[model samples]
Target: MRYLYSLLLLCSIVLWSSCRNDFETEPSTGNLQFSRDTVYLDTVFSNIGSSTYNLKVYNRSDDDITIPTIQLAGGESSNYRLNVDGLPGKSFENIDILAKDSIFVFIETTANIENFSNENQFLLTDAIEFDTGANQQKVELVTLIQDAVFLYPEKFDDGTTESLSFGFDEEGNEILIEGFFLDETELTFTNEKPYVIYGYAAVPGNRTLNIEAGARVHFHEASGIIVAQDGSLHVNGMLSNDQETLENEVIFESDRLEPDFSEIPGQWGAIWLTAGSTNNLINYATIKNATVGILTESNDGTSNPTLTINNSKIYNSSNAGLLARTGHVKGNNLVIGSAGQSSLSLSLGGQYNFTNCTFANYWTGSYRSLPTVLVQNYLETPEQIFVSDLIEANFNNCIIYGNENRELVLNERSEADFNARFENCLIRYNDFGFGSQGYDFDDETLFPGTIINVIPNFYNPQENEFMIDEESGANNLANPSTATNQDILGTPRGSSPDSGAYESIIFPEED
Candidate 1:
């Protein structure tokens, strides 16, 4: 009887608890709180899905509440999608929340910008609406969708990759490479849209890849543009009268649009110029965040320069900023900084001429062992060895400085002719323990009008600003004949120009 009474009492308690109306189902009191009033999905390419963003809907009242309707303003035809609780839909009804409890709403979008006629990008907006009786709560969603020409590696149905035929190896063997050649229709890039490259965009022999002003090119990881043998590349970026804006500058960077990745290094591969590629020119361009900014292979003994860079900047490279392997290069008003290795590397013998250029590497990412500038004449291998003559390497009105005491290094083999000169330039080198292995700046014939061991006083090294301040020792140090008439910003240099790529401009102080 005692066991039967206990079972009957337990049954009665269970029935009462099941039938109880403890949960409040009344309409909300028109008081709803949200974690954020707006959600920004950042920037994404057209027809590409964005990352998911979250919004929290909180109930601060003491009693439970139910939302009558929660829906997107655009209904079913909206580009944005949402997930409420564990259900994915555009609308929800009668969502219950306990006292002081919160629920998360996940939102994402893949905007179709085919109808957008803007030159650069379009703004996509939407709103999430919540209705509880006569009151309503809303959260605005915004995103910037950019239209771009997407380039990726081609994969065939048979699981094979597209391949191109380069010329040949030293033994006359055919060289097959892993890349696709661009057609004639895709050789030119205009300013109407940005380009997003996934694989190496190779320009075939006898073809030219031209990029107009204000054209932005974004590269994915380990992807870049490669000029094949007998090909050319022309980048015609110009600077407008407004020096503060990036309006007319052609930018080559990573595809990541996040702000945090703007300064990160090694985001992409190099702009590679293969052997026999000639007549390549890059003017008024900005290249950054790459493994190597510009790389040129061995020249084909042509008098034409392998690359001619003018009024350009290359920064934040994991390897050398400008790497030349037995190639010929000429640069004017060029600035390169923050390289993990040397800022300028002329290896395996090369002919280089730099005027009014700055090679500054203050890399703080790791302990750097090499100097800012490295010049070598020969490369050794176990099976064979090759040597070439460094015809001429002249630095005129240039600034070569870094955090280390010595910013220039020359490794010469006895068999090659190592000819280099520094004229009217500022260099950072202290000949304390560095013996005769280094070049002597005291020799006027080799180093004419060269200044040694002087502080450059750059405006800001941490921010990668290599411009000289007013109090810099390099002010008025360049000879007028050796310097370029115009600076990197298109500013005219006076009679006595300052060293480096930029001519110092004094700004008036405001009261």
Candidate 2:
């Protein structure tokens, strides 16, 4: 009788389980859907301030959702919390969210997103719940991905250690750059390879460079380097020309789209050599597309290192050709353009020595400040009117030319010492009276012994835009005694040299 009772109990249990499975009911509900799949928040914030962003949430479910109360997941204060309660956070009151409704969620952070850590995850308040039948409940959302961070290039403290492998993107571009930094370390780019930058690049702090020779670099209209004060650059490599590469090479790397000249203006920033740097050298390279070109400033009133440029080309910039605050610079083949602003203007404190250089202003209209060897450099526009002061300096074996024969005016009060000279150089000007002022003579004055009859260089003058007509006084000033002080490479205008940037280079006459 006991065995029979056990068997009956087992059968009863199995029968009840089968009946429950067959009679179970399914909940009637719609699939959950979000109003938008992605949200983008783009902003530029400094490290001194805080900002907030909001995300909206919508529910497409058929049942109602209840949110008791919203609060930060962690026990952190409201300063870093996304969801805040009206009063204290201990409230357990549930909020009934209707169908197809939306609610906004907030995310707050201190000034500068860089303060946030990588491990922190965004969380919503769970003080609310939803009934099974609630339709289209809404919730505010936050992004799971973090912001981009900057990583600087590695260098040794004592110039003995090797840098760790720096990572690059798929296109082989460097990532994570601090726009400004201050360090004494020197980074070397040794491989004699060509590098193309597709994005922005910067060297913010003081940097020492040991770049190898024959290294080709391209600053894709998007890249530039700015070195802050107390930082100096030593470039031993060559910067290749984009025009040369596009014309001769045929390499397929990525999308082959034509360059959009209109999209990028002053496509790249100038190489800013801040006030503290010294002893910078630029040799054998072509630098282009910069607005201000190469600028050096010494605000603290200390004469630092000398900027030496030998056998190089500086051309095609949009602003004042070369800007120098205070330094001793030696330039050769130093082609400066007055196309945008005045070409090669120096601040009141700058000291310059130029040689075998070309200063070309190939425009017709009058620029506010004509390019002059001045002690100061200022910003200019097409509508402004001004003449720069020709302060103390030497222009030897150099070419000075402007468009439509417009001459570079030398202000009456400015001083040009005897050492300041222009030799064997052409000075072309649009206004005949103003062009010969640099020679301390006029077009009507002429010497039979020094005169050489030649047609006016209406097209391209030998040097820059300034030229000499046979009957003009410029003829007698052709070979001045000032030319003697210049070096073989034409520099350091000695005592009583002519007033321009060229020393005679005796070349064999062509057959």
Candidate 3:
């Protein structure tokens, strides 16, 4: 008897739920409200997918409302894609919203910039139509697309992606890397449109890749530019007059344009200069958000400088801003903001020189264990360690500081010729490693006018602004003999110039 009674009660509950599920909704009135009348998606590259954006539809009436028809104005042929509520479709029918409740509509787009009229940026327009007849309503959708020259490896008929030959592996088998060599005609990048590169843009041997001023270069994940053996990379960037807008400066960064990725690091690989790639120059440029901002291997067995970068900025690298391995590099008025390992890493005994440069690493993304400037005369491998000649690692009127206690680290192999000198520079070192490395603070021969553990008094290192304050310890610390005449901003560095990339400037007080 008890079992029968329980079964009857369960049946009654099931019937009630079935009836509740069959509840009806009234047709939506013309007076429906929306969270926003228009949804503007962020800009995207031509043929690239845009970030997902959402819109809300409100049903404010007492009764549950049913939208008779919800579809895009361009219909099935529209570039925009819609996902109404939880159902994905080009057009949806009988979309119901509970009383005083809302439903979300997600939008995404993949469009060709050529399809849209190019007025400044290629503007794409579409509308989400709700209901029909006199009760029709619309929620506008817009997207801005920029035309870009996309460079990627050609796909074969198979599902596998094409790859380039990168020599052989230990097993005597050929190793293929994901990249393609740029042809002679495609070597030069003009300022007409931005370049979107997938995989590595490998410059062939003895070839030269020129990037014009005002040109923007974006790389996809694990992608970068590789100057082959005996190749040259000439980035011809010009200094802009307005400090706010570095209009003529060339920018090399990740392809992601979303706000979340603006400050994130390690989005792409490095601008790699392979062994024997000589005569590389980058001026008035910004290179950011890479595994390594600039990776230099062994230089051409010559006295010529491998790379000469001036008036440039490199920041947000996961590894190192300047990673040189047995290479020779020179820089003037250069600024490296932050990195996971070292802002300026000279490993395997490299010849590096920096004049009036700022290497500040305030990396908070991870618990950083390395210093801002790490100089090593030896390279560790699985089999054995290799020690080479450093010759010179010089810094003049530069600032090497970071969140770490010792921003300057020297891990040397005594057998190698590790000669380093700092002249009129500010370095943050509170540890005793310098003493153990056979160095003296009072040694005028190696450390002349070099301030130790003194605060740069940066306006804000967290925001990558190294502009010093009036009471900065770095102010007037630079030796007049070694200081550059002009800062990175083309600002005149008077005879008594301050240290770092920028000379101390008086900013107007905020009202």
Candidate 4:
């Protein structure tokens, strides 16, 4: 009888589970409906500048939404502008006319438009959520604004260092410099000339420069920085009066203005380190005022060169700080300043390492992907920075901080080997903690990846010990030998061990 009763109880439990009525019913949200979950624009223009093709936005749910404030991405806000007045509280608007209710958005800038580049980007935000026109609850919205085809003047030179300065006219035409290489091989420029690059300054042959550390390089008319397969930049540092060597500090700025806020790509390009590029080292440098900062990679990934960046700072560039393709990149002390519009972008699919690095993203206005490993880096619009799905990389002894809206996003399939460890670090942003991993993909996909492997015990900033979060590997990484010897400020952090790119400096205790 006892056995029969037990079997009956088991059967009852199964039957109850199978019945929908046996479980509590979730409250129906029938009134809520979204016009669209997301929207895209082929091109957009602000009072300052324009954007390139591929702009996108995210709708938090299936509900109506509105945008409150908007700004251009990168530093090109002087040419074009965005018109946000006609946009309904729940309706969206752009310069282009797209088929209503469709996900596809297409817009382009005119040739008459000014201050627009091929790399211009824009970001839009909506603070509060509201209901659709109906009785439904409103959904949140996030959008990327940009335009298609930010064109630049097509004039380039491949010769020895000369007094070359190029720029754009008031009508936005290319201004070329016709001169021979100077005897000193030093290209000096005056602010009177405003040159822009339609493409990039491609150094094909071997090149060397002895530039002043604080020299300003205004890339007003260059698409980006491309070191050809055979190119080489042996930027030797300068020795300061206090024994500080000359740091190669290159500032990238543009002529784009505000109102339309029109600046895009092809206005200023990225710095590409190609194959056969030898010993490209930069120290005590600051790379800012352009589209993308310093990048080391080949589009096909066959090039495997080495570059070292020590005691450097990269800030205010349009997108990432330091982007490494399939190569070897090492830095002793590096600081990456963030614009808060975008996080410090890193595509580490190669052998990359850092001794002491600091990444700061204090701005919390828009939502951006924090630096970590991720898959599917696709930015169809101005605000998005795409992650090239197939790459291997790591970040060590680094300090990563951001605001509440931003976060570090690591996809499920990406695997970062041991060299990708974040030892003695502090990462705090948004509603998330420093180190945690989640199951983002399932077995159905070819790649199953995770976001991070953090060692929580090591994250104690007060104790100055940091450990990468792992299922069980925290103990091994916490060894004292792994502590970074220096800080971003170029000071000794002490052997006692601190986390990330900073060390704790404790004075001697008084007796």
Best by TM-score: 3
Query: What are the per-model numbers of colliding residue pairs?
Result: 0, 69, 0, 92
Compose the digit string of candidate 3's lDDT tens values, residues 357-435: 9999999999998889988899999999999999899999999998888888888898899899999999888765565
Tens digit of per-residue lDDT, candidate 2, span 1-511: 9999999999999999887744232232324343344322222222211234555545556555555444443334322335422233322245444566655554443333334444322222221212234542333333232222222343458863223223687799765542323233425544433443333234444456544565444443434455555545666644334434432121111111123332122545566666666567776544555666677765334453457765454444566557775445767555564446656666533456665565666533235455433433222457663333333355554556555344344333233221234444555544346535433423332111122222223223322323222333222243444333443233454443332333333233468
* Reference-based lDDT, each prediction: 0.88, 0.44, 0.90, 0.43
Off by over 4 Å in 1: 1-35, 51-71, 82-106, 115-120, 130-135, 165-178, 380-386, 430-439, 507-511
Name the lDDT value of residue 268 in candidate 2. 56
Alpha-carbon shift of residue 273 in model 2 (angstroms): 1.4
Error of 3 at 216 (Å): 0.7
Q: Select the stronger candidate by lDDT from 2 and 3.
A: 3
Give model 4's TM-score versus the native structure.
0.44
Which lDDT value does model 1 have at 358? 93
What is the lDDT, from 0 to 100, of the residue 153 in candidate 3? 84
Could you give candidate 4's per-residue lDDT for residues 44-119 as a string of tens digits? 2333233422223334343333332233321132222232333322234222222222132222232222333444
Which candidate should be chosen as best, given lDDT against the real structure?
3
Off by over 4 Å in 3: 1-17, 30-35, 60-62, 118-120, 133-135, 158-160, 432-439, 508-511
| TM-score (all chains, Cα) for each model | 0.84, 0.44, 0.93, 0.44
Question: Which regions of candidate 4 deviate over 4 angstroms?
Answer: 1-199, 208-212, 221-224, 238-267, 299-305, 339-342, 364-392, 412-419, 429-485, 500-511
